[model samples]
Structure formats: C-alpha cells, structure tokens
Target: MTELNISTTAGVFDATAAGPAEGRPVLLLHGFPQTRLAWDRQITALAAHGYRVVAPDQRGYSPGARPERPDDYRISLLVDDVLAITEELGWTTFDLVGHDWGGAVAWWTADAHPGRIRTLTVVSTPHPGALADALRTDEDQRARSHYMLDWRETPKTENDMLADGADSLRALYAGKVPQASADAYIRQLSQPGALTAALNWYRSGRPRHAIGTIDVPTLYIWSTDDAAFGPAAAQGTEQWVNAPYRFEALRGISHWIPEEAPETLNRLLIEHLQTHEEH
Candidate 1:
C-alpha cells in the first residue's frame, strides 16, 4: 500500500493507494472517528484481487483537511472531498465503497454524480431518504439514533468520547474490530482537534434535501447487530435505487462490518464489481 498526501481544494488529505495502477479504480471512503485505516483488511483483499483501491482519510479526519466550522463538514462538502480525491487520481469514474458515515457520503456522491460512479457499495448505512423516514416515523429508529442527537446537542461529546483513556470510544467496537484496529482508530481520533472534527460531521446535521435514487449498479450490506441503524431503514433502502441492486444481510455481525467481517465483505464487493464490470 502507498500512503499519499493528496491536495484538494479543501486541503491536503492523507490517503492510501494500492493494487496495480492500471487496474480498475475503486474509491473507498471511511466513516466518522476513523481514518482510511478502517479499510485495512478490505484494502489488502481488494488490491490482491487487482482493484486499484484509493482510500482517503476523508475531510475532517485528516488534520490538514479538518475544517473548524461545522458547516464545512456538511454532506455536500463531504461528497466534494470524495470528488476531489477521485479527480486528483485522474479517475473519471470508479467503483465506490463506503462504510458508516462514509456510506452516507457515498450515497450523496452517487446521487449527485451519477455518471462518475460505475458501481456503488455501501456498508452499514442506508439511503438518506430511507434513514430520514425512519428517523421521522419509527420509534425504534429514533431510540437507536439517540447517540446522534447526543453528539449533536452535547458540547461534551468529544470529551466524553475521549475520556477515561478513550474507554468510551473503545466500547464502540467491543467485538466488532480487533484490538489493534480499534486502537488505531482511537489513536487517530485522540489527536488534538481530531475528535471535534469528527463530531462536526454529526453537528453538521442531515442533508437539506434528500439524496434520491442512484442509477448505478449498487450493493447494500447491513449487519443485524448495528446499534445506530435498524432493520426498517435497511429494508426500506430498495425503494431508493433506480438500477440493479442487491442487498445482503449478515445475521450476527456488528456495525463494524469492514473490520469484523472482511472476508464476507470482500466476497460481496468482488462479486458486485465483477457483475457490473464496465465493458
């Protein structure tokens, strides 16, 4: 894997590039409180499979890319960060993969730049519209998402996440990610201003307008143990895709699908990419 510092309009983002340069490009985006390191397992797998994988320490997560203002972390700008990374790589179009908050940005990216994404693979996050609907009408979803509200409303969210030697943060990935992987995430977010920037993603609030149907061939994966998202939203995702779509549900896995279940994730990703390989 090659670690690179990519310059974008926002700032320089730290990223990792792997696989043969001439291979099909695949852009991977990670979620809140974690850097591109979150893709460690899958990146190696995809690269070995001959996919050019580019995973970025998305805006706010990278020190140079961190913007102080909460608005800077809005959905559009988050999507722009992905676009800028792809542009920097000279990829006009690529297979897209995202997890957690990264999955949210991936959804908006596919919606806004339909032609630029050849295939969309979202892990553990549902379509914005489906999530919004769940938040608005489903009591269970509302309860499940209480952490988001706390992150948005409480000024101490950062401290709370970092206190007790980041015990709170460690709990998030209990059985989901190995200790080393969880430690890596904690170390990144534990940096000064890192936790704040990550929290800004939540403080930025939901998208003003819903991200609608994606036209590209898409794959959505969800684990039954995810605490933040529930079954209703996951099941409701089918309604938002206008093209070929496949859904895979992992009965016992947790929200940290990429880390907890890399083999399964890689198999699904490889199949999805091959099935929709651009001729």
Candidate 2:
C-alpha cells in the first residue's frame, strides 16, 4: 500500500491507498482512536481483487485536518468531508465502508446522499437513530454507553488516558488488535491535542447525526460481544434502511470487529460490494 495526502475542501488528509488507479473506487473511513492503518488488511485484500481502496485519517485524526474548536467536528461537517474527499478522488459515486465512529458518518452520508453511494457497509456501530432509540428504550444499552460521559470530560479523559503511560487508552484495544497496529494507534493519539481532537467526535454537536432512513443497498455488521452496543440497537438498524439490507451478527466477536475479525469482515464486505455495483 502507498501512503498519500489527499486534499479536500476541508483540508489535506493523510490516507493509505492501494489497487489499480482505474479500478472501481472504494472509500473507507476509520473510527476514533485509530488511523488509516485500521484498514490495512482490507486494503491489501481489496487491491488484489482489482478494487481501488483508500482509507483516510478522518477529521481530528489527521494532523493536517485537525481543527481546534469542538464545533468544527460536527457531523454535517464530517459528512461534508467525506463528500469532498470523494470529489477530490474523482469518484462520482463509490462504495463506502466505515467502522466505529466512521460507521456513524457512513450511515448519515448514505442517508443524505444515497444517489452518490452505490453501497453502504458499516462495522461495529449501528445507525445513530437506532442507537438513540436503544439508549431510551433499552436500559442495558444506556448502561453500556455510559463511558461516553467520561469521553465528554475531555480534560479528565486526556489525563486518564495519558497518565500511567496511557494504560487506559491501550486497554481500549483489550489485546484484540495486533500489537504493531495498536502501538501505532497509541502513538498517534498520544500526540499533543490529538486525544482531545479525537474525543471531539463524541462531544460534537447533538445526540444523533443521521436524520432519515437510508435507501442505498446496505450492510450492517454487529458483534454479539460489543460492549458499547446491544441487540436492541442492532435489531432496530435494519428498519432504518429503506432499500436492500443485510444484518449479520457475529456471535463471539467484539466491538473492534475490523481488527479482531478482519477475515470475516473482509469476506462479508467483498461479497456485499460485489453484490452492488456503482451505477
């Protein structure tokens, strides 16, 4: 894979890219606390299959794109960045995939611009509306998401994550992610203002980013053991999709689905992408 700096209307974003330039375009967005490295396995696998893949260090995660004010990290702006990045890549329409926080952005983008998204694949995170529904109706889900409260306390979280050599931050991976990849994530987030900027994703704007049902052919992958989400959230996700939709539950997997279950996730992703072509 080759590293690249992609210029968008917002700013230059550091990205990891691969595959033939003429191949079908695929844009992958990484979640918080991680960089474009999160998609390493998928990038190589997809490039071999003749699909051009690019995963950007979205928003606050990229040094060149990080903005100081929390308001700059709004979901509308994040979605704008995605649209702008695709425009910069010369893709009129493309397959989109996202994980964790990235998945939230993906859901909103596909909903807001279904005509431009040939397909949607999201891992580990449910649609924001579904999550909101669960948080209100499902006590278990609300309890699970309580850590988001701590994340909003940026000063405390930064200190807790940085103190003791960022033991708390490293523990987020729970040893599920590869050591090298996890180390790279820790190093990037440990940089000055990086952790706060990353946390801004949680603190940005209001409760939900997505407003309507999505019509794009969609795939939602949820792991049974995901601590931050529950069955209630996953069950409601399909209802938010107005078009062809598939929901897969990995019985023993965790929230870090891409890292912990790359092979499974990749197989599902490739099949979904193949099932839906850019038009």
Candidate 3:
C-alpha cells in the first residue's frame, strides 16, 4: 500500500492508496478517532483483488483538512470531501465503502449522488433515517448511544479523551483493535487540535431530519455485539435502500467490525464488490 496527500479545493487529505491505477476505483472512508490505517487490512486484500482503493484520513483526521468550527464537520461537508477526492482521482463512478461515522457520510453521499456511486458497502452504521427511527423506538439503541450525547454536553470531552497518556482514549479499543493500531490512532488524535477536530463530529448535532432513500446497490454489515447500533437499526436499514440490498450480522463482534473481523469483513466486501459491475 502507498500513502498519498490528496489535494482538493477544500483541502489536502492524507490517504492510503492501493491496487493498480487502471483498476476499478473504490473509495473507503474511516470513522471518528481513526485514520486511513483502519482500512489497512482490507486495503491490501482489495488491492490484491485488483480494486484500486483510496481510504482518506477524512476531514478532521487529516491535519491539512482539519477545520475548527463544529458546523464545518457537518455530514454534507463530509460528503463533499468524498466527492471531491474522487473527482481529483478522475473517477466517474466508483464503489464506496465506509465504517462507523464514515458509514454515515457514505449513506448521505450515495443518497445525494447515486449516479456517482456504483455500489455501496457500509460497516456497522445503518442509514441515517433507519437509525433515527430506531433511536425513537428502541431504548436499547438510545442507551447504547448515550456516549454521543455525553460527548456533546461535556465541556472537557477532549481533556477526558486525551488524559493520562490517553488512557480513556486507549480504552475505546478494548474490543480487539490491535494494540499497535490503537496506539497509532491515539498518537494521531493526540496532535494539537486533532482530538478536538475529531470530537467536533460528535459536537455537530445530528441532522434535524433523515437522509433520503439510497438507490444504489448496497451492502450493510452489522455486528450483533455492536454497542452503538441495535437490531432495530440494523433490520430497519433494508427499508432505506431502494435497490439491491444485503445485510449481514456477525455474532459477538464489537463496534470495531473491520478490525475485529477482517477475514469475514474482507470476504463480504469482496463478494459485494464483485457482484456489482461499475457503472
């Protein structure tokens, strides 16, 4: 795999690129508090399968792309970064994959620009609308998502996340994230203004409404043990996609699906990508 600084009108994003240049283009987005390295395992696998993949550090995570204002971290702007990065890469239509917060942005992007997305693969995050529905009806999801509210309300979210050699932050990876990977993530976010910039994603309040139906072929994977999203959200996601859709639930896997379950994740991702031809 190769690391690159991709420059767009909005900003320069640090990303990891793999596979052949002439191969099918696939853009991957990482979630909060993690960098493109979160997709390292999948990146190598996808590249070996001849899919050109780019996983950007994303808006807040990329030093050059980090913006201070919470409003700047809105989903719309994050979607903008996805499109801009693809445009810079000269991709007319590409497969899209995202995890966690990245999955949220992926849903919005596919909904807003289905023509540009050939296929969509998301891990752990359901459609915004489906999740909204679940949040309203499912107490389990609400209880699981309490941290989002707590992060936004607490004045020292950053201090707490970064204190004591970032023990609090380090603890987030107890769900089997490789110690080396977690250490790198902590070091990246521990940079000046980086943790706050990443936290701004939580600070940017949810959209008052849900995202529209996504028309592209979509594959949604959720681990049963995920603390953030419950069965209500995962099962509700099928109704949000108007095209060929598939959902897989991994038993006992945590919120960190990609890292905890790379073999399964990679197999599912490869199958999903192979089943759909690029538009």
Candidate 4:
C-alpha cells in the first residue's frame, strides 16, 4: 500500500491506497483506535481481484488530519471528510466499506448522498437510528455503552484511558489486534492530542440529521460476539436501508472482524461488491 496525503475541504488527510489504481475504487474507512493499515489483508486480496482500495486514517487518528476542536470531530464533519476525500480522488461514485466508527460515517454518507455511493458494506456497527433507539430504550445497550459516557461526558476520561501506559487500550486489544498493529496504534495515540481527538467522536452528540434511510445496494455484517452491539441493534438495521440489503451474522467472531476473520470478511465484501457492480 502507498501512503497519500490528500487535501480535502476539512483539511489535509493521510490515506493509504492499494490494488490497481486503474480498477474500480473502493473506499475503506476504519474505526477508532485503528489506522488504515487495519485493512492490510483485505487490501491485497481486493486489489488482486481488480479493485482499487483507498483507506483513510480518518479525522483524529491521522496526525495531519486532526481537528482542533472537539466539535469539529462530530459525525457530520467526519462524513464530510469522506465526501471531500472521494471528490478529491475524482470519484463520482464508488463502493464504500467501513468498520466500527468508520461504518457510522459510511452509513451517514450513503444516506445523505446515495448517488455518490454505488454500493455499501458496513461491518460491526448498526445504523445510526438503530443505535440511537437501542441506546434510549434498551437497558443492556445502555449498560454496555457506559464507556461512551465515560469517554464523552466525563472530564477525566481521556486522561484515564492514557493512564498506566494505556492499560485500558492494551486490554481492549489483548486478544484481537496483532502485537505489531497494537504497538503502532499505541505509538500513534501516544502523540500529543491524538487520543483526545479520537475520543471527541464520542464527545459530540449524534449528528443533527444522522438518522436516515440509505438508498443503495447495502450489506451489513455483524459478529455474534461483538461486545459493543447486541442482536436487537444489529437486526434493527434493516429498517434504515431502503435498498437491497444483506445481513450476515458470523458466529464466534469478535468486533475485530477484519483481523479476526479476514477470509470470511473478504468473501462477504467481494460478494457484495460483485453483486452490486456499478452499471
């Protein structure tokens, strides 16, 4: 993969591109505490299959892409960053695949500008409306999401996450991310202001018009053992996509779907991309 410093309306963004540059472009957005390298496995395979994969480090994670204010990291702004990057790449329409927080951004993008997205595949995140509803009415979801409040609403949350040499982060990736990948993330967040900027995603309230129906060929993939989301939220995602939708549930997989089950995730994504090939 080659690194790219892309200029967008928000600011300069750090991105990684792989596969044949001449092939159909597929924008891959990664979630929190992760860099574009998270898609390493999928990148090579997709590229071999005749697709160009572009993965951005995203708002807070990319040193050059970090915004100054917490409000700047809001979901709307994050969505705009994706749009700006795609436009900067001269892509009028392309396939989009996002994981975790990246999935959240992709959901918003597909809903707000359906024509710009030929197909969408989201992993390990529910549609915004489904997440919101679950957060409001489901006690289990609320309980599980306590970390969001701690990171977003509480004052010392950022400090706490970095305390004791980022022990919390270490624990979160203990069994998931490879040691090399985990080390890279730890080093990146160790930089001044990076972790705080990342945490800001939770600090802001949901984007004003976050909840909307996505009108494009869509695929939602969920792992049964993901700690952050439950069956209710995952199943409810159907109501928000007004187009052809496919939902796949993987048993025994964790939230780190791409890393934990790369082959499986790749197969699902390839199938979705091929089935919804642009005209």
Between which residue pairs do clashes occur in model 4?
none
lDDT of 3 by residue, 1-279 (tens): 888999998799999999999999999999977888899999999999999999999998999998889888888888899999999999999999999999999999999899999999999999989888988999998998899988885448888988899998888877489988998999999899998888889988777556899899999999998878899999999999989999999999998988999999999999998888744
- Ten residues in sequence with the least summed lDDT for candidate 1: 152-161
Model 2, span 1-279: residue lDDT tens: 888898876888999899999999999999977888989999988999999999999999989899988889989999999999999889998999999999999998997888899899999899888999999999999999999887998698899998888888889888888989988999999998999999998888793433899988999999999988899999999888888999999999888888899999899999998887744
Per-residue lDDT of model 4, residues 1-279, tens digit only: 798999876778898888887899999999987888889999988998999889989998988788867789888788888889999998998999999999999999998888899999999999989988888889888887787777775447667777898888777775788888888888888899888888888887767754678899999999998989988889999998889999999999999998999999999999999997853
True-vs-predicted CA distance for residue 238, candidate 3, Å: 0.5
My TM-score estimates for the predictions, one after another, are: 0.98, 0.97, 0.97, 0.96
Task: Quote the positional error of residue 127 for candidate 1 in Å.
Answer: 0.6
What is residue 103's positional error in candidate 4, in angstroms?
0.5
